[model samples]
Target: LQTIKNHLVEDMFASEGFRSDLFYDVQTRQNIVDVVKKNGKLKVNDATMTRCDLLNTNGVIHVINKVLLPDHHIED
Candidate 1:
């Protein structure tokens, strides 16, 4: 759906990537790059990266354990 498409950002696979992009909240700021790099696994914020590089008609989907919100901040 067009609504879904607008909600998603395909920059996760970009050269610089959207790992630690900051977002503004109520005239405040937050760091939404709480990504965790373990052994070889990646977890963004509190959502663990379950899958990646999935084939989608529109774009790729990176599965995660939790539903990520627009809150800024990511684990270092």
Candidate 2:
């Protein structure tokens, strides 16, 4: 489970598109790490217990987790 989580984090870092974004940038990665440190629930170590969603944002509103994270990119 931990291995899967590690792989997912590595994949996110490896993704060129994701790495280019400001919102999902290095700061966000650090924020996620901080969140996990502060809250155990945010730490995802198993595929079955973990999910992610990226939503289109308009100004301040961004919907996420309506369902599981889409395997493909969400059209902006």
Candidate 3:
């Protein structure tokens, strides 16, 4: 879905140093989704990164513990 793909950025966070990136969520009509690294933990809004830097022919993939949906669809 566009919402999920929207969460992905073109940058490789593994070696680039995880500061922050802005993504768009089409489902919520939101223009900015925050992906941040704090205390050595990478978080996509609220989802914590479980596995990271999966190398492939396409690009690197980072696995998160929770689903990255819009705020309205996710519970606090």
The Cα local distance difference test for each model comes to: 0.49, 0.25, 0.59
Tens digit per residue, CA lDDT, model 1, 1-76: 4323323664435212433444211211222345545555666655567777676777667777775555534543
**Per-residue alpha-carbon lDDT of candidate 2 for residues 34-67, written as tens digits (9 for 90 to 100):** 1121122222211121333443232222122332
Top candidate by TM-score: 3
RMSD of each: 7.1, 14.6, 5.3
lDDT of 1 at 34: 52
**Sort order, lDDT high to low:** 3, 1, 2
Model 1: residue 9 alpha-carbon error in angstroms: 0.9
Tens-digit lDDT string for candidate 3 (1-76): 7567646666555724655442323222333455655667766667788888889887788887876665533222
Q: Is candidate 2 or candidate 3 better by lDDT?
A: 3
- Candidate 3 structure lDDT: 0.59
Could you tell me the lDDT of residue 52 within candidate 1? Answer: 71
**Ordering by TM-score:** 3, 1, 2
Task: Candidate 3: list runs displaced more than 4 Å.
Answer: 19-31, 71-76
